[model samples]
Target: MAGSAHGDIPLTTISFSQRPNGTVATVTVSNPRKLNSLNTTVLDAFLSCVPPLAQRSDLRCVIVTGGLCSVGQQAFIGGADISEMKDFSNAEAGRTFINKLHLACKALRNLPVPVIARVNGHALGGGLVVMASADLRIATSDARFGMPEVQRGVPSTIEAAMLPAQIGAARARRLLLLGDTISAQEAESWGLVDKVVQADQLDEAVEEWVDRLLKNGPRALRIQKKLFAMWEQVPLREAIEAGVWEFGTPFEAEGFEAEGRRMMNEFQMQNRQRKSRL
Candidate 1:
């Protein structure tokens, strides 16, 4: 894929490759000196990178993670770059800074395919908010998560507000109020992360999810993801009605109908052959 960085920000990178006959794009955050902090530059790079990837019809999934670090290092993203925040002397400056981060997060969430967060280490404050924006997250056992923005004298905002829908209001409140980090296990239990694996298995877990997603019909997956986003915005009854309408959409679309029938026939044929053999 074309490079993601714009201007002098060389820390962020987007690598694209074919996997299971579909495109898989990875966005790596690589500011090791600052523990992969999400500075305005990096967030700007992310915003530029993700939209093009999202628009690709062949793209199946996007994986966001920190670039490789030393064996025992800790940080997917330590947080927003404090140095950048220190100069936020006015409400407008603070809004501008946070808005940049929000745009990055929004770009990720708007991707047509699933976005998977591969959380290898620390994901604190804005880092944690970024992780929450992903459609799914798989983290290493040693990974840490928290919303410590409050500790830094700023309440978590934008995608950080997504925590209530992710891990529940009570748990989200605890993290936002206390600014305490939680282990990967606790994060999984609280529904912040979908799975936790050994550090060595982090890539394997991500690959497994990617493979699972790839196995489904692309159009169906896209529609499902869109419906998921819609559910978040609508009331329960309206959401259910929308979902039912979505369920019948494939049949209304000729290509999806043909593919679904073909798959069903293959499945029935396999079952019949097995029964006859028995």
Candidate 2:
């Protein structure tokens, strides 16, 4: 695990760690005592981690996992800290918090590599948003997923917006409006989580998925990620134009041209050898 400390942030609510897995990096969130609630400190620490990650050519995938320290063998994160809500009496304070939250989510979404959520336990409220923002989500059978914000007297702002896009609008409302928690299995059924594994098998499941991702050509994955980010904003032709330039421009650049060509040649050679044997 690797990270530079961010001691300047006043809130001690978030901790960061970087664990290298071949070409993939795993950034863990360990604030179990606080149910992994995100405050200003946590957001700052996360923001500090993003830029360096984006610049790494070796990175192919990323996984974000939550810490579990609460009662029962359940949940990755219970929810955000309601106590922190006491300070937001006016619109300005609420707007500031929301903006920070939006930027942090955007940073995760904009990551050059695919980001997976390894949901070890319960993920609720803002924790759920983090999971949703990830490109893929894998949860343990015992894990519970939900947005209990309504129960705490607040609307599910960011999550409400993304959840509908992930699952259908109806299923998203069923969970958000009712504030009901669902098992990992049910979440997977509704497309909230991509997969659910036995508790003991969670780590292995995550590794297998990462292995599959790394097997693909890196440039292909990066191009796919760029297109995905643009799909919602631009028309088909414009999005294609944007993605082609976003992806192709880098290839013509000095270092990328050589490395990418070499990798493609190697991949073709491997395919040819395998086909010959077959």
Candidate 3:
């Protein structure tokens, strides 16, 4: 909303609301006073709350968003709180800040189900990385996305490292080096986000994705999510082999074996139905 993240309105916090029988969760980070900027309070809340969703058997999808402002702009998350960071006196304080921010995003990345970033407004600096951590991103047409940490005299670190993969290295460099914000359309075209819709259509677009994801087998989604994260850190050949190895687990590992069998039976039934008239 402004050039600096120093304003204050409501208390910084993160809240999770489960919708429609607990299968979908919407985690909203509210710091409207600062345009939903990330600070210790909200980031700590995120780190504490998000990782536990991985254990939710009833949870099918998570929509991470910073709710829209009064004027209906997506104030999704405005980045780190400059006032807090400006007061940090030493390297240790900075490292501590980075660690918390990194862990919060790591929690998002490690989620068992798909994470959809419901980008409503300003996702800049740390906010951009938080959006990048999601499996999919649905942004409002007026959403603003970028990395402006350089302009603030700080290097974008931690999850910012994922930007080159999210958007290209050159594009990520453009934002980081120039401290510029890109429009939602540009972000989608550059691969920084997945979908862009008008503000009025944001929730509908997100729900469409959520519904599609909910149709998949839960065990398959969880296994696939774990594998996707692994693929990012391993060699290409190794990643492929790991997928093969991972599928074998469903044949006899832990609690997934039974669910895998059930899915197989369903698949067989569907195949048979396809051979006949519905």
Candidate 4:
């Protein structure tokens, strides 16, 4: 948000960009000097920034990225600013810091549209959880992942709780207890990441996901994401009922039904044309 007092350079920035069509957006965290680490300022930027993106009615997908460094380090988010936290003198301050971190992650998770984490670098500690908060993650082959807070004299908590469900308990334990970073390949095998590619191919991989998402029904995609969040929190029976209710949602009160009708008619006409050609 705000830069240094002298205005020579920005201290940290969470910048947002949208496609010309306004259906896709990118949120880039730029603190390259710190490998995009989350300081209070950076965390505050996330808190203030995500809501505006989430509220966009035209947005079908959001891609989150970590800015690249001059030295070619792919640090998505190295962690909370350890240098900034080393001076914490009170329990209240520690709690406040952690609360900010949790809120930032929750903001990403709360987006109605899919959040694709285009992780090009290290997603360690808090960064890993932020990456997890995304609906899907596409990391570079050299990306690193772990929870090294244990090494810094603190247990990994908060959204670190999500690791077990994402990567299974054994793998999650290996990360938290051992404080060792895993390669992107290992992370993909463990189900922590959806896909991994070379640094040069990272943008292509992300665009592929975005293009695929754009082909689907926009309203259905949003409803599906909402149901996904519901399914994660509720019992199987309730989740099923929620889906049942949503099954007829597009055809119900809102103008979403018009989209459904239009697409169905287009598909049927295309199918008829194909049959006649045969």
* Top candidate when judged by lDDT against the true structure: 1
Q: What lDDT is obtained when candidate 3 is compared to the true structure?
A: 0.81
Give stretches of model 1 more than 4 Å off. 1-10, 70-72, 253-257
- What residue pairs clash in candidate 2, if any at all? 75-121, 75-122, 76-121, 76-122, 77-122
Stronger candidate by TM-score (1 vs 4)? 1
The TM-score values for the models, in the order shown, are 0.92, 0.82, 0.87, 0.91
lDDT-wise, the better of 2 and 3 is 3
* Candidate 4 regions with alpha-carbon error over 4 angstroms: 1-21, 70-72, 253-257
| lDDT accuracy of residue 99 in candidate 4 | 89
- Candidate 3 lDDT by residue in tens digits, 1-278: 11222444433333445555357877777777677888888777677678887887888888888854544355888889898999999999999998998998888898888999999888988888889899999989888888888888889899888888877899988988998888989998998888899888988998888878877777778899989898889999999998988887666755525767767788999999999976
Ranking by TM-score: 1, 4, 3, 2
* Rank order (by lDDT, best first): 1, 4, 3, 2
Report the Cα lDDT for residue 197, model 3. Answer: 92
* Candidates 3 and 4 compared by lDDT, better number: 4
Q: What lDDT does the true structure give each of the candidates?
A: 0.84, 0.75, 0.81, 0.83
Write model 4 residue lDDT over 1-278, tens digit each, in one string.
Answer: 33422222213344444555447767766667777788887777677778677787988888887866545576888888898889999988989999899998998989999999999899989889899999999999998998999999989988999889888999899999999889999999999999999999998999988888888888889999999999889999999999999987777645534667767777999999999999
What is the model-wide C-alpha lDDT for candidate 1? 0.84
Q: Model 1 residue 72 lDDT? A: 52
- Cα error, residue 156 of model 4, in Å, equals 0.8
